[model samples]
Target: MDNLTLVIALAAVAVAGILFFINRRPARQTAVETVSHRRYAGAHREQARPAADADPQTRFVETSKPKQYRLLNSSEQELYHRLCEAMPNMRVFTQVGVSQLALARGRQEAMRLSRMAGRGVDFVVCDADFSIVAAIELAWPTTGQEIDNAEDVKRVALQSLGIPMIVFRPNKLPDADTISREIADAILRRNRLEAERS
Candidate 1:
């Protein structure tokens, strides 16, 4: 091959290597939730294991508490933070990447989390309400199914996976004020329940 052709081939290989690392890295620890009950049991044990700061902060908003768990645009985080604080003693972890399924060594991360849900996790938190609001205001489409169908899809997904989904919405969202409060409250509830000593 010519020098330019050789350079292009090297670049292609480098790009491929990077993609593989990203997809396969972290060694799929999160995906272990899909494989065995034992694995999920282990994960629950592990997930519940205290971080250095896992004391009073571990108390989560109960799952019954209303909250939407949708992902938000950057501009909305501050408002959401305030709303989260508005709840009595809520500490929220908002860093979840939509594409990042906590798993280990498998293509079936969703399945792992599905099983994990059965083990202990009662709710899946995604702030889908804003996405819905954004869809309505900007007329963008995020769901593969129609909104009603999409709602069913979401409900069914969690049911089959054995978890309730709490989609937290932005409090300052100009549209859909009613739904946003509902979703936020649901999420806040779950955040409180996770580490509560029964």
Candidate 2:
């Protein structure tokens, strides 16, 4: 054979040898993976899907039943009534969001607004002109210290925007007369502070 023929034959032989080696090698086995409870639940749910052609048991039955719940519990309801009685001249709103009373400003407006949006006052007292006066938080007798700390954070955030937070324990609620006086005092104190700052 010519030199070119010899080179071609040698190349063909090398290619065949590589193919034979590849065919004779044992197939690699992938390790068995351990599935966690969470993952197994997800996989089982995926595998247990009903067939498309299978009949649905309750084709005409309505499964979603939504029920209404009271916005305030018994303690909160009592406080709401007391607030209304004490501040009859003013408007009292329940479950009020902090964002409604204070707006975020400056460079971090969105971030600040989001933080305020997540926090809310149990009750809000507003003047005749609809300006917010004070925020009231009713601390339940059975609450933990974490709730108290969270309330403190809310108080500081509201105070920063010139709004005062009044905390009243449900079990130790003051009478209407006392409540009215406390609100007046808080408003007066806030005004004095603002005047001094100005």
Q: Estimate each model's TM-score.
A: 0.27, 0.58
| CA lDDT of every candidate | 0.44, 0.77
Minimum summed lDDT over a 10-residue window in model 1 is located at 130-139
Compute the lDDT for candidate 1. Answer: 0.44
TM-score of 1: 0.27
**Per-residue alpha-carbon lDDT of model 2 for 64-158, expressed as tens digits?**
66465889988899988988998888998899777766652234543565676767889888889877678899986546888778887889777
lDDT of 2: 0.77
Which ranges of candidate 2 are over 4 A from the true structure? 1-68, 104-113, 141-144, 196-198
What local lDDT does model 2 show for residue 157?
73
Give the lowest summed-lDDT range of ten residues in model 2. Answer: 26-35
What's the C-alpha lDDT at position 88 in model 1? 30
- lDDT score, candidate 2, position 178: 88
In terms of TM-score, the best-performing candidate is 2
